[model samples]
Target: MNLFATFEERVAQALRNLQQAGDLPGDLDISRAVVEPPRDPAHGDLATNAAMVLAKPAGTNPRALAEKIAADLASDPRIVAAEVAGPGFINLRLDPAIYRDMLRAVILLGEEYGRGTGQDTRPVNVEYVSANPTGPMHVGHGRGAVFGDALCALLAFAGHDVSREYYINDAGAQVDVLARSAFLRYREALGEEIGEIPEGLYPGDYLVGVGQQLAQTYGPGLHDHTEAEWLPVVRDAAIEAMMAMIRDDLAALDIRHDVFFSERSLMAGGTDAVAATIADLRARDLIYEGRLPRPKGAPDEDWEDREQTLFRATEFGDDVDRPLLKSDGSYTYFAADIAYHRSKFERGFPVMIDVWGADHGGYVKRMQAAVKAITRGEGALDVKLCQMVRLLRDGEQVKMSKRSGEFVTLREVVDEVGSDAVRFMMLYRKNDAPLDFDLVKVREQSKDNPVFYVQYAHARCHSVARQAAEAFPQADLSPENLATRAAASQTAIDPAELELLRRIAQYPRIVEAAAKAHEPHRIAFFVHEIASLLHQFWAKGKDSTHLRFVNQSDEESSLERLALAYAIRCVIASGLRILGVAAPDEMR
Candidate 1:
């Protein structure tokens, strides 16, 4: 199914044949030899660096080795010509029938056309959008949620056992602030004349719902209790309410996590798991008591020269040892995170990823260092930081202040545009770069919005299929008939037809490269490329009637072209699905 892989295998077999015939050195290593598409499409269909990679090992000049490999490759029926290019790269021009056969593969496979097998051996966990349960999710969390969910889908499509996770920071001080805020609302719900919220408390209308719920449950009967008796009761109530709101918000954006890990659960029982994890690292001499020097740029106000429990993060490339416990003898946030990661490693996932906001960029090295110390460098942790999002409306800023509780939530954005538009626009940029999301621009029907452009391509293909059915009443267009039809026209290809097939053939390679680089933005770019090709091919039909899909005179030729269009539509749908975007059958 991977044309590039197939071509590389053929080239390797040819090289081995040469060695067996004593035409080349027998001791050369060709593992690095690879075949890929040429950067410039006009150069060739595919290019390889077999000779260049083997030159020094085989004790031969690159150009000489390239010419030898070219002669050997030209012997194959699929290869029309193999020419030696600059230095030792071999540019390959394949028989057009090979591309035609690939189009048939697409038609036969449909939405499953480009699914891969390399990821079948491992399990991956992608944890993201773990924004605190204190408030509704904002635009920043939207990007992380989309990226992590799309990454999970991509890995799953590529055959990995993928799990989407969200870590709930319910055990932190922020939730206590939330509880006190809700308590005030609870008093107000009891008809007390509570004044404006104090300086250090949460002031948002969201807690009004939680307060109302508390009022419905307890009424005025719970007002006489002390903070000690009522804090835990209302804290749990407030967290549940806030989490319910968060889940609804995520649901609006079409994101769902398989696991929701609670930080409070790690220390709920008599056994403190954070202490247990630190003890495990201490046994390995990774934990020590030390005093951290003041940070280079800014110093903490309460920082004093005193000995404290710390993790030896410097051994794993961190700037300094990180504090494990705070001044009050309570575990720091970093300590809780260490236990969380240990729990992940114990669950047997060799690879783990945490999607965080860009403000947490400085925390990456320390978290990585902690993972290394816990797993003794046996586990992997990658932190993906999503930069800020600037919202604009009609080219003017859509202003909102996080401090004022006036910012638009993720749910509102999804409700305005749609889940498809929100997911596509969020992933249209690299994770580390700041993004400008224009509310006015993304809703447009023009090509400026990539979501509409790609979806329009899918819709056009469906339109072609509908028109073809009317033109060729005898052709079977159902999935059950696709196999027989694919077998019938396996070797039929035109110039424009071959171009569309080439894009389909590149799908698996793009998936593998993007997965390896941990870059989901590549998926957006690839979708754009395929959409461009489909649009160009569609436009060509307007100028040349012979290239059109619905030929009134020849039923067979029209069916064949419809089959090709169907294949392109299948590829577009599969790619769009992986990106968590919908491939609509109609634009309106």
Candidate 2:
């Protein structure tokens, strides 16, 4: 169903024929050869760089090889013409039947139309939205959440067994801080008005519920207990409460993780996986006691030359060897993270992808290094760094401060603007770039908003379908009927329909490429392009009565145009599903 791939193979077979005929060398490498849409549609349906890629290796003139390849390709029934264009490029003009058959294939396949040879499935663990269990999720975390969720969906569509994971930052000082913050509220709940929240503690009213729960459970029996006596009880309560709130926030956007792995669990249950991982590394001589460089770009006033337990991360492509334990003999966050990833590997996930915030950019190389050393290069780790997000309204920046306990939560954004807007707008751009999320523009019901525009295309397609059904009640407008026909009605295709088909046919390849490149933003762009084409065609129908999808006088032509519209709806729906956005039948 992938025409480009089909034609690429055709070109390769032509090359092999030339080699067998003794006209070209058999050692020519065709890996770089590609078949794709021409720069200008008027040039041809598809173009290939076979001659240019193989000419040097084959020891032949570029144009001469191109001519030979063109001749061989022209022999194919589907390829109507293949001409040598500028500097040995071959522009292929395919028979219109190829496109008609593609439309037929689309109608026949429906949602499964563009799915490529996703190659069975590979176990991929996509860990995202691993926000600290201190408070509700923030905007930056929301970006990574949507990107990762959409990525998992894309991978699934491309046949990957994806595990949506959330790594709780619960085993660290932050959770203890969360407990202290809630303990202040607990005392307040017990009628002792604790003054302003102390510094280095979470300052949020969300933890007030945890305080109430503590007051109800222990009633004032533990009010006078020392820090050691109450720390675990209160810390565990706060983490559980905060994680509940986090899950609720994520649910508002309709996102759910398959696994919520706790960092504390790595060292819990009387089994310290972190220690075992370090021991394994120590046995391999990758772990050692060493001293690290004092400082780099920032000031480290208390820099010490003390020896610490370190991992030889440099051997696995890290900038420097990394520490496995903190000065207090407790395993570092990196140590637990290494254990978590090693566990993922042991659980049969050889491919691990972490969608992290931009601030974690410096941590990527080291994490990749750890995965390599732990799995002995059998496992691969790819970290996607999501940049900051600036929420804007009326062209003005909306500032927030979580330290002041006043920040925009992911729940608030989704509740106000709806999940569809939040999901689509988050994926409208590449994750690596900073995004300016305008509150006003995304909700606008105009072409200015991509989400609205793309959804409108799907709506418009269905609207046209309904109209066609109403106008031609007796016409055989079933997908089987319309698709089985040569044209919509045997009428010559307007250039617009041809252009739309070309773009429609590009979906399968786009899915495969985006899945391979790990970019779901490509789907957003493709949907928008399809919408624009449909809109252009709809606009054209206003001036030309014959261009209108409904033809009361010619039922066959009407069914054909409606068939095209239905195909467009199918594509937009499939593409939108990949983006985790709904493709409504009507744009209400």
Candidate 3:
């Protein structure tokens, strides 16, 4: 159903014909040859650089090769004309019937039409939004969550065996801080006058419920224990409660991970898994004791000029060696991370993708180095960095300070604007670029709000179908019976409808390219274009009464347009599904 892929195959087959006719060399490599939409619509419906790519390899002039290819391609009924353009490029003008066929393809394939050959069967593990188990997820975490969840769905649609994962940072000092904060709340819940929370402690009222739950379970027994006796009990309770809150926050946005890994479990019960992993690296000569060079453009504080346990990251594309242990014989966070990734490798994930915030850009190389050193470069790890989100309300900056616990939580934002708006806004820009999230703009139902614009396009299509059903009671254009009619309607199409069908036919190619590039924003951009086209097409029908979807006198054209509208709705719904947003059949 992919028109671009179909055209490329047609071009390749034409080239083989040339080879058999003794007009071109047989051994020329055609792998780099590509057929795509022309940059300018004036050029043609499609263009190819096969002649230019094969000319040098075939030891022939590019212009001559292009002319030969163009002549051969023109023989196909689908290609009305092929002309040689600048620097041996072949511009192809497809016959109007080809576009008609494309429209028919959309009607026939419906939602499944755009899914490509994807990963076939490669198992992929995507880990994202692994926020420390200290508090509720904030707006920044929302971007990563939306991006990761969409990516997992995209991969799954592309036929990959995908598993979504979240790694909890439970074995850190932050969790201890959470425990103390929760303990204070627990005391306050038991009718104790636990005064103002001290500085450097969690100050959010979200922990009040956790405290009440602890009081219900332990009553007054927790107050009698010392720090050592109560720390473990309290820490465990706090982490569980925090994770539950986090899960709820994610569920609010329709996001759920298949696995939640705990860092504490990697070394719990005297397992020393981190040390064991380091030993394995050391045995392979990838670990050593060395002093690291001071980081560039960073303040030099406590320049410890002594040898320490280091990983030979340089051998695996790292700029400098990385520390695996601290001076106090404790595992560094990097050490624990390495062990965690190593565990993923052991579990047989050939492809692993980690979605991290932009602030961790520097961490990418070292993490990639660790993966290579552990797997001997057999497996691949791709780290995607999502830049910061700047929240604005009513054109004024929405203030946020994590240290002061005054930041907006993801739950709060979703509650205000709904999950559909939140998810769409997060994906409206490239992950590597900073996003300006305007609460006021996103809430608007106009064209500026992409979520509503796209959703409304879907709703409009259904409205057309409903109108057609009322006009022609025999059509039965309900969602359930629309599929069979769509397939039947693919045999004929108008110019405007065909253009939309061409775009619909490109979905699989778009998904493959976007997923391969690790760019979810492409999906957003595509949805926007689709919405724009649908709106324009609808406006066209409004002007020409003959072009309207429901013609009271003609059942055949009415059925065709109704089926086309149904096809557009299905594709729009599929794209929205990938973004973790709802596609409404009716706009309220």
Candidate 4:
């Protein structure tokens, strides 16, 4: 049950009542009215600006309209009190029974609590972690990977069918280099004396196994041909090995994509989707042969002033037209990407989200423009750019260099702190904000560590549940049984109980907002908020023994508090599941 949604409908009904009584204009547009938590907790439980939004349109003063709305809302049994404050905003105090009902809903729904009702009628394509197949994923890719995965889970929880996708860059010049690097390894596997890797080739020892695999596939005879003759053969082997390694690396972080689309597939198959996409744009007069302006801010020695193939991205709000083919007569990466997104639209995904790196911020408008022009504005694309993540060890920066092949792999980080820590810390900050991931701090059992703090809140609930079970052995405290117990009882809500339930009640709104904004960091923040409340409430038990969840002195109040504890636990567990973090019963 979404308390905010229910109150919003109530507010709308109040406005309709005003219209029916002829106190307000009948033709007022009130769709913008909303109900949300008040700015200050002391003011009221929830607040709304319905009167302020409609006062001018309804030809009435905001205060007068607010008074009428409040009067109408106070008649409802759920809202015990409603008052106008600060010029027109209405503050509402809900009856304690509403908060109790929310807690009961939590125990009843379990993991499904806070799920929104606005189900997505169509499939959504979430393309993320599209790291090139040229090498292993780095710490930078880790942030985007976790964010994308969590965002996908959030959308799925919000009643959407989400498809997690990874676009592999195997058809570019980088894979050719990968193939050559692997050929050197193959020679080494055949007992040849290969010294240090030459420039322009991968130098990591990770390629040693690729070489051994090539040797087994063709024996010593594989070395009989030139790079031009055997390059394709070697490229296929390198791609296969590298992709396998990438899958294993993703699995280390508990991330697995539904599709690993190869760039080569666009041009390699019987149907050339790239050519077809270009033709589609050309037919619509969006494609043309035009010379691009010389790039500024740097001197280019190889700058060639000539006409080339271009797409009119500016027509759809891009900064400038984009090139689809290079001077070397090869299709640019952007061309292939257009075909990839076009494939998404053809497959019936009207909504598409791309998780890209911060460096690709400038690419968003062009991609959005391409989608608008190609799909004729039927498909919408949102690109979420995640900023760089600075990895720190014990408060000192851990330097990384992919050039020197000394970079830390995603697996190494996950192995060091475990996947739960890695996933939670990665999402502790906004996607567009820089995050400093201190390896030592995330594993700390103290309250300063958010992942541990949240997990501990969940663990505390279980501890209390166990105590309750021991305190009352005859009582059936199963989730189903406790929900029935909660449903049958209606007791006064202690301010402490109200605080916890109100925080947990915000979960559905947070999930809906985060899903719409394409931001999973909000979930991390909300989970931490509820976790903080749980911890504070748990601490209250130390000084006030009467406030403890397990009270051997009184079975009825203890059961009620136990049910409340379980509700908090469910919310934390659900939020952590979406964040891809573990809700540990005990922290090791």
Q: Of the pair 2 and 3, which is ahead by lDDT?
A: 2
Q: For candidate 1, what is the TM-score?
A: 0.95
List TM-scores for all candidates, in order. Answer: 0.95, 0.96, 0.94, 0.97
Candidate 2 local accuracy as lDDT? 0.88
Question: Candidate 3: TM-score?
Answer: 0.94
lDDT for model 3: 0.84
lDDT of 3 by residue, 1-588 (tens): 777888899999989999999887888777788988778766878899998889988989999999999999999988888999988999998766665455556666666767766644768999999988888888999999999999988887777788999999998999899999999999999999988889988998888888898899999998999989988899999999889989999999999999999998898897877988999999998888878777668843322567888898899998888888778888888999999999998888978999999988878998998999888887789999998888899889888644336788888889989999999989998898899998899989898789999999999988887788688876666544554455544344566776786677667778888878878788888888988989988889878865777778877777767766777887888888888889898999
Count backbone overlaps in model 3: 1
Per-residue alpha-carbon lDDT of candidate 1 for residues 455-517, written as tens digits (9 for 90 to 100): 998999899888978876777877546545555664446677677777788988888887766
Evaluated against the true structure, the overall lDDT of model 4 is 0.88
In candidate 4, what are the lDDT values of residues 116-189, reduced to their tens digit? 75566678999999887777888889999999999999999988899999999888889999999999999999
Which residues of candidate 4, in runs, are more than 4 Å off?
Answer: 296-304, 400-404, 488-490
Query: Which 10 successive residues of model 2 have the least lDDT summed?
Result: 296-305
Residue 275 CA displacement from its true place in model 4, Å: 1.2
lDDT of 2 by residue, 1-588 (tens): 788888889998998899899898777677788998899999989999998988888778999999999999999999899999988999999988888888888988888878765684569999999999889888888999999999999999888888999998888887888888888889988999788888787777787788999999999977889989998999988888888888898888888999999888888889989989999999999998878887788854323478989889999998788887777788777888899999999988999999999998888998999999999988999999999999988699877755328787777778778899999999999999999998888899999999999999999999988888788777676778878873444578789889999998899889989999899999999999999999999999899988888878877777788878888999999999999999999977
For each candidate in the order shown, give its overall lDDT on alpha carbons: 0.85, 0.88, 0.84, 0.88
Query: Which one wins by TM-score: 2 or 3?
Result: 2
